[model samples]
Target: MNTRAGEAEAVDLQVQGRVAWRHAIRSLLAQPRGSIRMYSPDYADWGLGAPDVIAGLDAWAIGRSQTSVRMLGQRFEGLQRDDPRFVQWRIRFAHVIACHALPEECGGLQECLLLPEIGLLVIPSEKSRLAIYCSGARLHAAVHAFDQSWEHSTPMFPAHTLGL
Candidate 1:
């Protein structure tokens, strides 16, 4: 994706699968103020299938005022059972939103992050696996898909449980 705004440029990240995924998670963790929205098949099966990333996402919900939403594919059910992030966000009354659905639910994609004021759309390339941030109706539409899923999916706990 080309960076039309000049302020938001997609960085071509070059690293091993594990390293890149970890870096993405770390980036999400460091930015405590902004929100993180991701669509993945299963965190357990994903290359970044590590405990710390889950912990970090959990920490994000519990520690920050920001919102974090996860969109799980259809085959992904109860995948967040042991995830600290799921526990922290879903049960501990943290600021978070979680959702589950089939590939059709996610509008067909692996991962995405919708940043604040940046419009929408920061996707990882299939070949390069690098992150590309862009702005347009496309991102807006993807975010809409996220919103739809979040509204429709079941929470591990309850909305009132987290006061969300």
Candidate 2:
């Protein structure tokens, strides 16, 4: 299914077809960090507990160069930020996006865009569909959407800051 097209039928198919999604994820993991820009609504629950990928992101964030991760409409936050492993993230640019506390039907509490070089991964919730893109223009459009929602949200403590 081509998630990029916003087709509900496509998303439903992909969610039920684990084998196909698994292969796509593996391909994503194989890419170099610079070649990928990951945007997800929830980093805490992603990748089925893949330690290597988690560690790699931590290491990458710590370098003098900047690495960006944006969170949109997040419903829950994870505990990694307090861990020393996430120190790099604190110093870098991490944008958390949310709505203005709307009810769940309006797309729930979280929606994220993980921008990797290969494409954008949209993980709004569990078993959600992921979108792939190779163009910056596509990514930029997603970013704009995130920003629009983010602007309406009142400031709240990031889940990490709440000692989650």
Please identify model 1 stretches exceeding 4 Å from their true place. 1-16, 45-70, 75-78, 81-89, 103-107, 117-141, 148-164
Query: Largest lDDT belongs to which candidate?
Result: 1
TM values, all candidates: 0.53, 0.46
Per-residue CA lDDT of candidate 2, range 48-101, in tens? 234454455545545424324433334324534333334333334243222123
Model 2: what TM-score?
Answer: 0.46
lDDT of 1 by residue, 64-103 (tens): 5544555445544355564544444454544466555544
lDDT of each: 0.50, 0.40
Relative to the unseen true structure, what is the C-alpha lDDT of residue 18 in candidate 1, on a scale of 0 to 100? Answer: 49
Residue 112 CA displacement from its true place in model 1, Å: 2.1
